[model samples]
Target: MQACRSAGLARGLGAVTLPWLWGSCRRSLSLVCAGSAPRAGDWRPSAGLGSRARRLSLSAATIVNSAPRPLQPYLRLMRLDKPIGTWLLYLPCTWSISLAAEPGCFPDWYMLSLFGTGAVLMRGAGCTINDMWDRDYDKKVARTANRPIAAGDISTLQSFVFLGGQLTLALGVLLCLNYYSIALGASSLLLVITYPLMKRITYWPQLVLGLTFNWGALLGWSAIKGSCDPSVCLPLYFSGIMWTLIYDTIYAHQDKRDDALIGLKSTALRFSENTKQWLSGFSLAMLGALGLVGVTCEQTLPYYTALAAVGAHLTRQIHTLDIHRPEDCWDKFASNRTLGLILFLGIVLGNLWKEKKTEETKKTIGSRLEN
Candidate 1:
């Protein structure tokens, strides 16, 4: 009777244990499924898994926040972030117009409008070409590593397409000019094509850039006067070269580290420690050259006064510059736009004033002869 009672108890206990064990196994499998599944809000942390997950989420958020914004990529490629290039390219053209108009009349609205459009199209084209050529090298430089071409945001073929579009717009603008202006415009292609390669072979790519950028000075003179006279255009062009050197040196400071790592050469890297002194010399030279041009052209008193404003602007740029800070360098470089505008207005007002004086002189002389 006792043995039979003991066997019944053992059987009952086994029966109860089996279902409990199976239920726990099922619960474990469910937890594993929940953890591995891709559905939203289905995370099942095992033991200490919750903290690790929080860390991962925070890291992902940080990366997304820190990544370069999408719009910046486009702006970087176009160099819209750096407006100095535009000013450098545009100012020389403005000088040419002012100088060309010196002997005749002030720059008309039509000429100014043409120059404005040309500056936009040509600067875009130049940047695109520069990016396409520097794509491989850009990938190696930290500052340029994430640029459109280097980061694979735009392919070589896409760059070529963009180049085509820019050229088309520029060509359309060129067609609006006279035959001589058109010819002078076409002649710039050689310089444009050769400019990107200059950094690879020479430290004086700034000089090459001066030649390329200052072509506008020549074009402006030719567009207005329909002929090339060195006496009128040379001073403006030479002044442009010096201006390019000064501003471009500032620009180069932004890339000094990346350039050094990539084995690229620039005046900034070449004159790293003494950049300020060199810049001072260049600025003084530019001012002197411009002064000579103003005197030679006999620009009106207002024009000279405007040039004095430019001198003040240059003084401010030099005084506040911290070449070690790229942002400061860029700001100083961009301030040149104001300089360009002041000079442009000066040239226009000067010519207009001269014309008014000439008319008054003629009237007085005629009255005297009549008397």
Candidate 2:
């Protein structure tokens, strides 16, 4: 009878506590989704990942959390939990490499592999650098305050040490490329090293990020041709910058309201009420630059078809944009991954079509010679 009474008491307590616990969880989720900072002791979640979660139903953090406690902070620091930035950085490289394919051939698979691996290391390094520069600022931002460095899960010295390690690994990747490409890749570091400071000095920091993020457009072509000529990749590079301006602007809005409170700079805060118009202007510029890429590379109809798709996607993103809603901005920003994939596919298919025409011409010449 005593044992039964103890079980009954535990059941009664659980019934009383469960609803309150659920309520807290709901409140917490709301605050997180709304970009509101949680109290110091509360669990902090990642922002801009609701769409990612709904799609993958899992995240790097969830998987890394299952690992040993010692590794969780580092993995988050590298943004292994958020792979979108890596994808964004890498796709431009693929687009450049693929666009520069030998007439009727795929881009160098070996070079693509090198660039892909390099992108992972370099993007992580970039994030580490950004975190290091922004740790103090991060502490003041709702979405970023719990970042590994800002939360005191990792130290500044450790982050710099870690940054050094990433740069060393990236150097090894750079050594695999030809001298011109190596030099080009190395020069990009100037932009990377300086990008973090742009937010403090200019509302157009997204422009600086564009310059940094899109270096792969030049690097990709130079790796294949052993030279980066202005005539060949300038258009591609410009297109990438315009594209970055569009997506990064959307990304900036997520932080704009907070940035105003903190006096940080961004295109979102700069464009304010006229974002859709500015995005439209950027879109036209990107499309025009992409058309130049087709002309310079002599890409075929399939390439334009894919470009058309890219255009439609960008249009839809702009049309649906609700600048006041951070969640809406995040969804639009995340959609750029799909845009990158589409553009890559377009480049690949255009080359395949060129290859087919080349084969057809060769076959016809052989028949004539036989006759």
Q: Which candidate is the best by lDDT?
A: 2
Per-model TM against the reference: 0.75, 0.83
- Tens digit of per-residue lDDT, candidate 2, span 235-324: 989998998999999999999988999889999999999999999999999999999989888898889998999999999999999999
Best by TM-score: 2
**Candidate 2: where is the Cα deviation over 4 Å?**
1-58, 363-371
- Tens-digit lDDT track of model 1 for 172-208: 8789778999998899999998898988888888888
Q: State model 1's lDDT.
A: 0.69
Pairs of residues at least 3 apart in sequence or in different chains that clash in candidate 1: none
Worst window of 10 by summed lDDT in candidate 2:
23-32
The RMSD of every model to the true structure, in order and in angstroms, is 27.6, 16.0
> What would the C-alpha RMSD of candidate 2 be, to one decimal place?
16.0
- The 10-residue segment of model 1 with minimum total lDDT is 24-33
